[model samples]
Target chain A: GAGVSQSPRYKVAKRGQDVALRCDPISGHVSLFWYQQALGQGPEFLTYFQNEAQLDKSGLPSDRFFAERPEGSVSTLKIQRTQQEDSAVYLCASSLSPPHMYMNTEAFFGQGTRLTVV
Target chain B: SQQGEEDPQALSIQEGENATMNCSYKTSINNLQWYRQNSGRGLVHLILIRSNEREKHSGRLRVTLDTSKKSSSLLITASRAADTASYFCATDVEAYKYIFGTGTRLKVLA
Candidate 1:
């Protein structure tokens, strides 16, 4: 697609329920990222993937939060045994490549998955 | 933990007025980026200024970075009601990690 796309715009899950949110990055984009945004706060980094390999998952809140870019194009963030604290907007973003040496490689974001744990 | 902190958690301004937001970071960054979000939706990239380059402009958006002070400022000229949104500052640390700040909520009243 032209922009990053995320599935289940809104998800209401009961405590202990497992929920999966999906993301389809822009075609041919090699870098993908997942972030968690709590109410009245900035999006916190959850994980990053370069192609199909997850380069970083240090920011995932806990074991309950798992993310994968199986084919490097589509990605999923799964939260198992969802807790109330897990309620937030899960955002997916993709970029052409690392901006380290590149002049500009801005991230394109998805509308985000709003997950509510009841 | 966040690498940057934004000042003035919220701001209310009249239309046509200029709006300014500031962000301060702790570590060295390859570049600093500004993004805008409306009603908690997806964020749109506004502008980016490299660490070596002090300033950059995009449309009415002007961004200035002070690597020595580890701070950056975003200025929106002649803000409009449509400009109301949450503005966040992110820093690309090392090569991969992009750390975001708390963000500044801007309200431009018409």
Candidate 2:
């Protein structure tokens, strides 16, 4: 089975520019998650979607960060007015089931989009 | 705020030896998961242990959890050079968000 896939493995953007990163989850996956990883740091939660419903967006750092998964198969994380602080690797993951009672289920990940804001 | 923290930010060991990493969290969690990541790559799920499980083994990997202490440890025995990577622990907080630890960089010399 194909793993999760993301586009634009590397992106270099100027400060104040807008950037959009794409994520294609595995077929039939019901849950998707987004995270941001700074240099030499662990990934920080961004947002979550379940079958087209954005269940949680609390993890989004600010209003400049937005995400959507209208059809529930593919998702896009968009950053408006990107800042140098936004420079980091953006990761996407998917799981066959929800992380509620089946919390231990593994979540497959993509190589991630490394965005560099200058 | 971060929920989990891994100790010994970096470690170096010889192949065929054992490598151990520990993680601690500040809140209650439904489960804990361990992930491995190569440099310039995404994370790979290594194992997951529910709150009720005390220990689990996958091949040469061993994971143990202590809910009372809100801590977990991952142990790899007879490590190979290929085992060198960054190890991170994530917690399923309130069954919604997966909070990851700072991670430990392990280097195995062959």
In model 2, the runs with Cα more than 4 Å from the true position are: none
TM of each candidate vs. truth:
0.97, 0.98
Tens-place lDDT digits, model 1, residues B1-110: 76589988899999999999999999988888999999958999998888888889999999999999999999999999999999999998757678999999999999
Candidate 2 docks with a DockQ of: 0.81
**Any idea what lDDT model 1 has?**
0.91
Residue B61 lDDT, candidate 1, scale 0-100: 97
Each model's chain A TM-score: 0.96, 0.96
lDDT tens string, model 2, A8-80?
9999999999999999999999999999999999999999998899999998999999999999899999999
Q: Name the top DockQ candidate.
A: 2
- Which lDDT values do the candidates have, in the order given? 0.91, 0.94
Q: Which ten residues in a row have the lowest lDDT in candidate 1 chain B?
A: B91-100
Report the TM-score of the second chain of model 1 against its true counterpart: 0.97
